[model samples]
Target: MQLPDPSSTRHPGPAPYLRIATEEAFAPPEMLEIYRRILSGANVDPGFRGLMGFYMSSPSERAQHIMRCLTDMDALRLKHMDDCGVDMQVLALTSPGVQVMDKATAVSFARIANDYLADAIRRHPTRFAGMIAVAPQDPQAAAKEIERGVSQLGMNAVVINSHTQGEYLSDTKFWDIFAAAEAHDAPIYLHPNSLPPGMYEPFMEAGLDGAIYGFGVETGLHALRIITAGVFDRFPKLRLILGHMGEALPFWAYRLDYMHRATVKSQRYDSVKPLRRQPSDYLRENVYITNSGVAWEPAIKFSQDFLGADRVLYAMDYPYQHAVDEVIALDGMTMSPEHKKRFFQTNAETVFKIPPR
Candidate 1:
């Protein structure tokens, strides 16, 4: 199918836009080497080996794969922006976030990653804005880095990968980090990574088919934990953004609300706010969901219906999925021009606070 030309007279200038979530804009040689090591070591599992084989066919192909990964980080991001008419991108640290390491290692890696991202934004300020990566393992350090990232680096928000190395965001231990984020008025964008070791080992043992099924399930549960823990109640201004269409939470929203409403016998915790409204209500109010991996029209429409158009934003998952295809899918969907405008451009601009061009 011929996609509509965003630049055509029918579409006029700067047709709406698309933005990417949790993309590493710069992968230094050292970083690439680290990723190569990880990918190579990740082959301990036959399923992982097969996946890596699909990604890296030959020994000579490793460099190209690494370059492709880096290009996916930067050049391909821009190429997608051009193809999708994305005016600006809110870039963030890629998966597992800074949570996967010990405190010292996490702090060091967060600094390195944030510095690289900051430098990339400096070089392409118009095209990219940054999201700081925090190591919630150390709340005070995370708070300090967040302050530096925003005040010093001009980063717009923070991107956290789903569970903090198995410690869910709702854990009281990380309350200080949430408090700090609330203080800064910066949104937290939560992206997903592999499930913590034993948690999803059953699925992995049966070959990696579970990755597609389980990652979203685990991440969705993590997001739900935040809601149940009343994180939003304490930090009313704290904004949380979830990618991959809220990791499939939108579809199960009604069930969540029903379960909460039906459980009156467990009212022993009367001090809690009673979850007074629908679970989805908190999601609509405190969370912003991005269209990253799932680009289907029905899913988009359902997300907008559940979260509202203003809470939805365009996001190309990148490397995993092509931006060109995402643009074509979105353009082909049947939605009002106004809703499309909000989904494609306006909402992200408002959320990320991107300056108008």
Candidate 2:
């Protein structure tokens, strides 16, 4: 909650890099209604529903303020960006966004939500960018939305907040989205949602499912699912972005490769098919990781070195982890100006095809 002054980290001379936060978030009120209804009706544990119910209700001032932040794109947010020196924001829908809704609502509401974001970005192209929200509940419609969101609306990236219900992205049911994203050359941002229904029972009491630990586990598994399930093989040119430093995956890159080669080759899981490249290779080549809500420099350093600095990006994870101190810390990374430029600005330009600013 305490925000540091952005001016504290600046050098006496000009700024070193232009910061473009890739995981900036916003949620339309209409989308919130859909999530409330879906969560209430979902066949999950009762306790988890209770927690979601409380979260949906603004029980405390902090909760209320957070909700306000999600919907407001006024001068306050821009001031925060200016205070933190963030040049542009790739605004994606918040977690569980339309991902939890029923087919009809998800389809209709996602369009409305994305259209609002597009209009907002159009009003301020220099400071803000848009990311498409596609509801996987209906894959065909979702694919079309991807096409429209990219070509028609000029949104830079596609964002799906982790799984839909219990089904992950690797399932063949969602291939149309993968194909559309690849064709359009827009990277899909694989954000973290809460743990799928059944799994949340264990963590609901302590609230681990909402990003303390479960989000990383669930999202890391989702990315791994895509890699192992041949999603990348099917759409080799498709690119994916992961927040929280690849949801804690890059640190174990070698272990994943070693284990996959030793075990997958020897005793192939029925679920995992053959991959043209190893899991680590797909991660290095096709995946871009962002340091969102993850201020630890060691993780960023390791991710840049291991995944290649070209594959690493900067993000503030706004409204949730929007601490000014995090930005100051990231600006102080011990790397060359070129690597910092790539992390802050160039990687986003190349990935999102953002026009000259």
Candidate 3:
């Protein structure tokens, strides 16, 4: 499908618009070598092996560009943001980061990345905001970093990619991460990653492992688990940011509530009692979503209508979507001007408590 060039469609003659993007990503220099080691490791699973091959299949010039984009914060990144008409970005570590590492490696590297991001934000206060990268594998350390990131480093949000090894955030052991977020009122931006081998073996070589099928299914399931596991009840203030337009959950929303009620009411569920609230309630109240990698207008409209526009924010899913003349494409969407304002700007500010520019 053909689309308009975002450059041509961007806000004409920029009157200093405050477009605070909630989900553009970057990988720190310290974490880059760690990933190279992981990727080059011999024991990497077959499904992941295929996904890595797909990304690296890009010609040499593009691969070089991807590496530079992953580490650079000042020159090319800022220039692209300017070109795309993005006034500010809430930057995060790209996927398969600390989640794949052993606890010691994950802990030390999480600090390094978070510190890099914190320093970057300090240097360019107006241009960037940072999300803390905590290693979920170690809950105490993760909680400590959350406090350090928020109170000490001036970071505003937290990001944990969907799973660590095979464990989801819904597991009780990870509740400290949730508690940290609620205590500080920091939103946890749960990004997607490739599925683990056990769950992904069926789609082994069909190219269904990463972003296409695996990310949405695994992330959506993770979100549902958080809801059904009574996570919201424990920490009502804990808010989550789900990317890729709620990972296709908004469309099937009502059915989730209905079906969940039907099964639980019928004693099909093993738990003695059903959830105090319907699943949809948790999604609406505790979750916020970003139109990052997926920018389809219909999906954006549905997310706004279903989840409330206040809970939806704009992002470019950078480096991946980094030709961000593509970022301006969101300007072409046919929403009310008011909705557009909230989508691109205010919602992010209010949600992240970003001080005015």
Q: Which candidate is the best by lDDT?
A: 2
Ranking by lDDT: 2, 3, 1
Model 1 quality (TM-score): 0.83
Candidate 3 Cα deviation (angstroms), residue 80: 1.1
TM-score for each predicted model, relative to the true structure: 0.83, 0.92, 0.92
Candidate 3 local Cα displacement, residue 254, angstroms: 1.1
Instruction: Write down the lDDT that model 3 would get.
Output: 0.81
Tell me the deviation in Å of residue 282 in model 3.
1.0
- Clashing residue pairs found in predicted model 3: none
The residue-by-residue lDDT of candidate 3 on 1-357, one tens digit each, is 565454354442363247777887788766766666777888875544565444545567756666678788998988878877788989998887788888999999999988888888888989998899999999989999999999998887899988788898878999999999999999999988878777787655666766777788888888888888889989998999999898888887889989888888788767424777888888889999998777678889988888898999988887766645555557777888889888988898888878865
- Candidates' C-alpha lDDT: 0.71, 0.83, 0.81
For residues 1-357, could you state the per-residue lDDT of candidate 1 as single tens digits? 443343432321344544434333334455444444555663343333333334444555543544465435467667656655555667766555456555887887888888888888888888888788888888789888889888888887888877765678787888888888889888988777666664656766765433377667777878888888888888888999887888888888888888776654467565334665667888989999887766678888999988888888887665455445556657767999899878877787788777756
Superior by TM-score: candidate 1 or candidate 2: 2
Candidate 2 stretches with Cα past 4 Å from truth are: 1-14, 38-52
Where in model 1 is the C-alpha error above 4 Å?
1-28, 32-67, 71-77, 83-85, 208-211, 267-273
Clashing pairs in 1: none
Off by over 4 Å in 3: 1-16, 52-62, 271-273
